[model samples]
Target: MDQVEKTLNQNRLVLFPADQLQPGERKLVKVDQIEIAVMNVDENIYAIRNECPHQGISMIYGSISGTMVTSKPQEYQYGMENELIKCPLHGWEFDLKTGRSVFSPNQVSLHIYDVRKEDENIVLYLRRSPEKVIVQDFSCNHK
Candidate 1:
């Protein structure tokens, strides 16, 4: 593995005190040269990349709301309440639970990290993919 990848895989960075962020609030953190947006939704912690895929804007300034859909005229369905984050610049909605864009769930997505409570601190796990390493090796050999 590359040195950076190895270091990331072995590290579990403590972001902040778990109680620092109140429910329905978000905070921005930097780790390994990447900006991460950490949120507390209904007491559950979620972390995602801070940049919006559309315009590279900071998603930490975005607004949070529920997922809304319409099945028919004048019939609107509301679900996944308080679990959606809308980009402040372009209004792109992302599901905090799955990190998928509401408009293009299949194609567009946000990079999400696993967050957990380690004692009184919030810990973030930087995940690395073995498949990515294998792909890099295959490309290097072909080149």
Candidate 2:
């Protein structure tokens, strides 16, 4: 049986082709040994970790909407459309652009990653370099 494999260490990961995502759409991807969410908000690229800080649930799968803005008691306004994602179970709204709590803005936040559409691909920059692996079979050459 062939048990050898080749691996490339990388500092970046391409989630998918840029054209696959349209404005206001998002995709979940697992690459570079991590799960992340890539989103296209008005043609802008945004990426974040999929886990919710509060409950360890899939945060990217939550509903996308704008957070509520207010002026006074009983007087409220909805703004920043498509910039917030509400948790499916807890209803905790998080800012997609800033990865912070929409209202609290300090109590909690998500891990945001550096992402961009480059060379027709959506690339995520990893914080650490991945280890490269290659097997050197000396017996094959000597025997």
**Candidate 1: Cα lDDT at 1:** 15
- Model 2 spans > 4 angstroms off: 1-10, 72-74, 131-143
lDDT of 1 by residue, 67-86 (tens): 77767888989887778888
On the 0 to 100 scale, the lDDT of residue 114 in model 1 is 79
Which numbered prediction scores highest in lDDT against the true structure? 1
Candidate 2 overall lDDT versus native: 0.67
Clashes of each: 0, 0
Cα lDDT listed for each candidate: 0.71, 0.67
Native-to-model Cα distance after best TM-score fit, residue 101 in candidate 2, in Å: 0.8
Provide TM-scores for the models: 0.76, 0.74
For candidate 2, list the clashing residue pairs, or say none.
none
Error of 2 at 131 (Å): 5.4
